[model samples]
Target chain A: MTYCIGLRLNHGLVFMSDTRTSAGVDNFATSKKMFTWSVPGERMITLMTAGNLATTQAVISLLEERSKTLEERDPSILREGTMFQVARLVGATLREVIDETTNEGQLKQDQFSASIIVGGQIKGGKPTVFLVYPQGNFIEITQDTPFFQIGETKYGKPILVRAYDPDMSFADAIKLLLVSFDSTVKSNLSVGLPFDFQVYEADSFAMGTTRRIDENDKIYQAISEGWGDALKDAFQHLPSYKL
Target chain B: MTYCIGLRLNHGLVFMSDTRTSAGVDNFATSKKMFTWSVPGERMITLMTAGNLATTQAVISLLEERSKTLEERDPSILREGTMFQVARLVGATLREVIDETTNEGQLKQDQFSASIIVGGQIKGGKPTVFLVYPQGNFIEITQDTPFFQIGETKYGKPILVRAYDPDMSFADAIKLLLVSFDSTVKSNLSVGLPFDFQVYEADSFAMGTTRRIDENDKIYQAISEGWGDALKDAFQHLPSYKL
Candidate 1:
């Protein structure tokens, strides 16, 4: 299992993903799920993968393998015209990998498949988030749906739905995501520490402030404990039910 | 889809459940998912159902039909000696209903199995809650596990995990539960009002406060609006992530 989220704010896009993957409860391992493909001043595309570990890694590796050509290949992500096009490229790669690896559709193959959140700024386009399905289709973020969450999303969703503001600062955006991820980590064993994160400021065309939040990051600790205490304090203030 | 929760506090028990049931997006109806049986000073039991509506309805109907005898008929719920025994009775009845309706297990039989949470005080015994599975097995709640949530539970779980206190007043317990339910209702259309709720104090051998909170209920409205504001306020007070 995995927990990943991407926020499309007025300032930029924020991405957060946990690194824990397990074949079963006993067989646990950590693998980075956040991948970045940037062309410096031109564009910076970020992706967070969830679902099948093998399929995600394979699709990402295939992209990296194709990306080394220096000149953008026929369907390379760097050569895409827009953020939507980049999502399409990633979706196609994911589909091809699953189709070649399994019989029937990947979703029906032992009921295992993968999904990705593709978000970034492409020179001429605005920063936005898109959730690409296993079937190679995608939907861009909208006002009503300002963010995209994949894998282990429900435990952390209420907070996002209530507090997300389109005009919030980049600092607030990442803090909001960390709170969401913290709730998920505490509730689910399959989602854990060393979360990879990055902020792609809109129009900057640069991947800025990338970091891995391990088990003992001081800021992460402060946010986790502070948020919990804040929730308790808030709960205390709510008017009690009329018995 | 339904969302029901039961909290086992040191002072008593609290039960809350949404009333909406939908077969498809187009077909929605309100059905009572919480039922109570009491022999006044002798005993009182509350049951909340979730899953296949038919299966749960059949199980509850069967238990009610047999309770009129005032004698422990074959496997009647009202005749159970302990809360654990009541859970076993409900589990076995649920299993019988499912087995009679399908070829395989309820879970595998068109995925129509039902689960239930049973809680109350049987005279001369301590108050407790038990969650009965579709397979006719059950487990009692304890100090480590202070609550049980069935059906669409994840969205409302983090709040419960972060703020639940066994020593809190009954007013606080139901307020906490209403906050949890409010979050679920806002995020999911499948789980909606009106909500049925009740509280049972330990050793009272009686049901305490009970109410059916509809969409226009004043307290429900206050809690719903108050919680959204409280959460946003809490989010603002959290330390921003230093990038």
Candidate 2:
């Protein structure tokens, strides 16, 4: 299980992913899920994946391999001209990799499953966010749904549904995202800390911010404590039935 | 889809459930998910159901029917001597009803498809809570896992995970339950307005307090709005990313 969120806001795009993977409860390990491909000012695409570790790793390896062999890879994401085209490229790569590995007659037979959040800007296009489904098909974020989340999403979904807005200030967006993540982490053992996050200013045409939030991070701590306190205070104010 | 939670606090027990059922996004209707079987001072039991409305309704009907039969029958929940006996009776009823309905049919069926939270106390026994699984087997709320939730539980699980404590005041417990319900209502279309809730006092052995919260309820509205604002304010107080 994983929790990754990609937000498309007026000020910028925010990408956050937890770094935890496991085959089972006792077999847990931390693995960074966020992958970024950048050609400096030309294009910067970020991918955060969730699902079967082997399948996710296979997909990432294939994409990274494509990035390295651009000449041989005709429709590579690195060479894509628009953000949409890049999504197509990523989807195609996902489909190809899932097919190659999960198809029958393979030594390690398993279900093909992986979902990715692709968010970035091409030199000539505006920054966009897309949620690629396990089937390799994708949906772009719209004004109504300005964010995309994949993996163990329910516990954290309420905050995003209630608070997210297309015109929300970047600060508010990030805070909401953190609270959302905090909710998920508290409930799920599969999603663990040392979060990977990046913020891209809408028209900056460059990566706006990137950092890893650990257990001791001040902001993360504040969000955790504040949310707990707010919930307690909120609970106190509700009308109680007089017994 | 539905969301129902049962909490076993030191002072008493709390049960809450939403009242919405849906086959899909297009087909939705309001259905009460909470039920009470009270003999006032002798015993007061509240049952909340979630999952497979047909199955839940069947179980409720059976329970209600049994309540009527207590006058004519030798053994029934109302006539039961102990809370444990009452729990056993409910479990046996659930098992019998599910097996009879699902086993005798040729229809494509979901096995033991409804989950229930049964909480109350007989006059002689201490207040108790049980989470009855679809299979008719059940688990008592313990000090370690003092609360049980069924139906669309994940959304409301986080607040409890962080804030619940054995010594938590009844006031705090009810507040927590409401906020948790609020989170669930916000996230899932399957869980909706008009919540039914009851709080039982430990030694009172009766339906101590109960309320039906609707969209127009002022206190609920305040908690919802205050929580959102407090979250934003808390977020503002946190230090921003330096980058």
Candidate 3:
């Protein structure tokens, strides 16, 4: 019921996520799924969530409370030593929320499960990304597999698998993610526009450009319409079958 | 899992199905999911299956036996009065198979459920397609929705939505489908090469070109490689985002 992408390029990390959340086909709302915490020059941690809204919001609120309460016993994601540690704390928080929510109910634990994509840089550590599972485990992005996608991922994946380039500019990367997200939005009703995106430069350790693309954004419209025309054109260029 | 598509065009109907069937990620084998029954100059019917292999194979075998036996009480698909009747018969047969399979033990009925895409033309009937559900019901393809895909369909759907044209030539349709299937095969291990395809021309009342495209097929290879390049080129043509 969501589509989120955390892509690691050679230059930096690019994150995009749809804002639509639905309890049923007829009930829908726009909710922000991207969260960020930065310490000026010390660290920058960006997290994108997909799955149960309550679990994700709880995890975010817990992390926020821990970070804001200077004397809290719980570790703060803001103060984590590295991106991996931040991912671990987020995973633990997700698991803790799911555990708490399901303990008093007859519902299955998976009903409240959520996954997170946590990525950023610590002052001395290299920029990277991790996909945190609902089980409180996570996997880091690698050279061979440089991106992570969660929820309603398949429709947009073919283009990403073909067009992703490690050394592309932030502008081009955004274009690629938009094309990917556009495919998903067109095919699935559960994922919609007003997408949130953030760009993190590799060594900056500070949050890069953060913006939201809504339905009327000129660039989004152009890409959405242009990509369809371009795909038809590209399809035509392929050699015809001899039947 | 399987991936099959049935597309209706102005000229006629096109069907393509992957041969891969898997019990799990590690257990896979090739199996034919496309079946055809033709009464020359009278009718031409093609059916594609996706879901439980046992149920599908049972339905196909039952259809074959009933059609072959001269005095069988059960109606044969080849003897149907209209394409709609043929689809109804297939749906009933599918439901029959699933019911019989699930009645013997503790296995859930859903475990034996299957879906079918049946399309063809009979005398005095227009070419059409129908998606037959597991409940012995179906809906015909309309002008607005000219195609049906079952199982592992999302990865390959965006291109079909963008590139499909009812008025296009059979060669173009095949090319379009090959591009769609190539996207699927590249992205999913459950859907792979050796795709089986059948083309039925309007008013032919007989089978059209039927073939299997394996890994070495030059055209498949060309499309598989060319589409990646074409997509990359198409992505490049989209305007870069202003970040």
The candidate 3 chain B region of ten consecutive residues with least summed lDDT is B66-75
lDDT of 1 by residue, A174-219 (tens): 8889999999998899899989989978888888999898989888
Give the per-residue lDDT of model 3 (tens digit) for A1-243: 899999999889999999999989998999999998888888888899999998899898888885455666454776778787888888888878888878665443367878889998998899999999887889999999999999899999999999999999999999999999999999999999899999999888789999999999999999999999999998888888788
Q: DockQ for candidate 1, please give it.
A: 0.79
lDDT of 2 by residue, A1-243 (tens): 999999998777989999999888989989999988887778888999988888788788777675556666643667878988878877887777777766576533245578889999988788899998766789998888888899999899877876677777666666778888888988888899989888888666667678888999987897788778765665555565333
Model 3 per-residue lDDT at B218: 88
Error of model 3, residue B6, in angstroms: 0.4
Each prediction's fraction of true contacts recovered: 0.80, 0.46, 0.93
Candidate 3 CA-lDDT value: 0.90
Ranking by lDDT: 3, 1, 2
Instruction: In candidate 3, list every pair of residues with a backbone clash.
Output: none
- Please tell me how candidate 3 rates in CAPRI terms: high
How displaced is residue A123 in candidate 3, in Å? 1.7
Residue B4, candidate 3: how far off, in angstroms? 0.7
Q: Relative to the true structure, how large is the alpha-carbon lDDT of every model?
A: 0.87, 0.80, 0.90
Model 2, residue B208: distance off in Å is 2.5
**Candidate No. with top DockQ:** 3
